[model samples]
Target: MRNGKATIHDIAEKLKVTASTVSRALNDNPRISDATKKRVLKAAKDLNYQPNNIAAALRSGRSKLIGVVVPTANRNFFSSVIRGIEEFANSLNYKVVISQSYDDFEKEKQTIEALLNVQVDGIIASLGKTTKNVDHFKKIISKGIPLVLFDRVTNDLDVSQVVIDDYYGAFQATEHLITEGCRRILHFTSAQNINIYKDRKRGYEDALLKHGIGVDPELILFSDMQLEDGRRIMQETLDRKIEFDAVFSSSDYSVMGAMQVLKENGLNIPQDVKLVGFGNEPFTSFTEPTLTTVDQKSIPMGQITAETFFEILNQKDQGSIIPKKTILKPELIIRNSSINKEN
Candidate 1:
C-alpha cells in the first residue's frame, strides 16, 4: 500500500482482486456479487480510500458538481432554498458550490465566470437586484452547460426556472391590508429592475385599483430594502406627514425596520397602522405582534430547481429540451400584524 491517498488499486490488491473488479464493486454494478461488494467496501473503508472525483470527471466528461448563486446568503429565504437544493443534489452523489452576489450585477457575472472556469456540470442561480440584462447567463447556455434560475429570473433567457407567483403574492398581501380597512397603503420595495419587485409593485397597484382606490405614486418607495432603508423610508413618510394607514414591505428586514420606527413613535400596531411583509422570515413570526407575510415556498423552489436540472441532464442526448417555467403558488400567513378584528 502506498503512503499517499488510497486508490482503488490498493483496495483491489488487499482483496486479491483486479482493479476493474474493485471499480465495478465500488460502483455497485449488478454483475458484482453482494458478498464481493461488501468485502470491497470494507477494504476501501479500512484503507480510508477516497475516490478521485477529478480523475473520474476527466474520464466521464462530467464533474458531478453543481454551482449555486444567490443574491445574498444571509437571508432566510435564500438559505432555505439552498438547503433544499443540497438535500436533493447530495442524494444523487452531486456536490454543490455556493456563491453570493450581494445584489451586485458585476459580482453576479464574476461568480458565473468563476463557476464556469471550475467546469461545474450545472448552475442554479437567483438574479441579483441589479441584474436587468441576462447576457452573462445566456453565455452559460452557449457553453452547453445546464442553467436553472430560481426566485429571480427573466423571460429573456431560454432557461428552466422555478419561482413563486410574485404578483399574486403581492396582490394577496395588499388585498389583505385593504380588507383590514387600510386605504392609504404605502409600499416599500427594492429596485423595479428586478422582476420579482416589479411584479410585486404591479400587484400592489392593481389591488388598489380593483378596490376603487386611485394609485398614489408617492406612496411607493424604492430602495435597497435594507433595514436602514426601511427605517429611513418610514421616518421620511412620517416627517412629510404622508397619509398612510398601512405599509406593505417587499422584504422582512425592511419591515422590521419600519416596525422599530412605529414602536419608537408609540404607534399601536394593527390599530393605528397595520403592516405586512413578503418572505416569511424566521424573525417575522417571533417579532412582537407576529408579522403577517407571504410564504414563497422557498425550499420547494430549490428542490424543484434541482429536479429540473437533473431532468435536463437526463434528456440532454434527445436534442435540446425546450425550456420550462415552473411557477409555485404563494401562501399568506395572517398574523396579528394585519388581522382584521371586525372580520
Candidate 2:
C-alpha cells in the first residue's frame, strides 16, 4: 500500500498484472477478460483500493463533483433541499460539497470563490438575504462554469433557476384568512429586495384587494422573519394598537414566535386571531392548535434544482446556458389555526 492507501498499482502487483490491465479491469472496460477482471476485483478488495478522484478529475477536466451553497443548513427546508440534491447527484455518481453563507454577502462570495478554487464542475446556490450585488455570480458565468440558483434567487443574473410560486402560496393563505372573515389581516414579511418575499407581498395585497378589503399599511410588518423578529413585530403591532384580526407570516419560525406572544397575551388562536404561516415545519403539527402553514415542496425544489444544474452543465460545451426559470406550485395545509368556526 502506498501512503497507507491501496492504489491501482498496488492491486496490479497483488495480481501480478500490468497497471493498465488493473485500471481497465477496475473500470470494467470491455477489452479486459472476465476472469482477469474478477481477479483484479478480488485483489482490489483485499488491498482496500481507492481511486484518486482528484487525479482523474485533472486528467478528464470533469470533476464529477458539485458545489452547493445555502444560507444555512439549520432550517428544515434547506436541510431537506440538500438531501434532495444529494439523492439526485449520487445517482449520477457525483458528490456534493455543501457550504453555508449564513446570510452574509461577504461569506457567500468567499464560499463561491473557494468552490471555484476546488475546480468544481458546477455550483448550485440559493442567494443569501444580504446578497444584493450579484457580481460574484456574474463572475461565475463569465468563466463559463455552470451555476444554477434555486428558491432565493435574483433576477439580475441570467441563470437557470427553480422556485416555488411564492405569490400563489401567499395569495392562498391570505384568501383563506379572508374567507375566515378576517378583514384586518396582519402580514409578516422580510425585505422587498428578495424576489420570494416581494412575490408573497404582492399576493397578499392582491388577495385583499380582490376581496374588497383594502391593504392596510399599518397591518403590514417587515422584519428578518427570525423568531425574535416575529415576537418583536407582533409586540409592536399590539403596542401601536394596529387592530388586526388575523396574521399571515412568510416564515414558520417567525409566526411561531408570534403564536407564543399571542398565547401570553391570553389570545385564543382561531377564536380571536386566526394565524397562518409559510414553510410547513414539523413543529407546526405539534403546536397547541396546530399552525396552518404552506408547504414549499423542499424535496421537489432540491430535485429540480439538481436537474437544472446538470442541464446547464450538460449544455456548457455547446455554449452559454440558456437561462430557464421553473416555478413549482406550493401547497397550503389547512389546520386548526386558520379554521375559525365562530368568526
- Largest TM-score belongs to which candidate? 2
- For residue 139, give model 2's deviation from the true position in Å: 2.1
Q: Write the per-residue lDDT of candidate 2 for residues 1-343, one digit (tens) a residue.
A: 6579999888887877899999899889999999999999998888878888778778889889999999999999999999999999999999999999999999999999999888899899999988899999988888888888999999899888899999999999999999888999999998788899999999999999999988888888999999999899998888787788999999999999999999889999989999999999999999989999999999999999998888777774637447899999999999999996654
> Between which residue pairs do clashes occur in model 1?
none
> lDDT at 191 for candidate 2?
79
In terms of lDDT, the poorest run of 10 residues in model 1 is: 313-322
Local accuracy of candidate 1 as per-residue lDDT tens digits, 1-343:
5677899999988999999999999988999999999999999999999987768777888889999999999999999999999999999999999999999999999999999887789899999988888889989998888899999888888888899999999999999999888999999988777889999999999999999999999999988999999999999989999999999999988988999999999998988999999999999999988999999998998899999989987775625588899999999999998976665
In angstroms, how far off is 65's CA in candidate 1?
2.2
Off by over 4 Å in 2: 1-6, 10-16, 33-49
lDDT of 1: 0.91
Report residue 290 deviation for candidate 1 (angstroms). 1.2
Residue 103 displacement (Å), model 1: 1.7
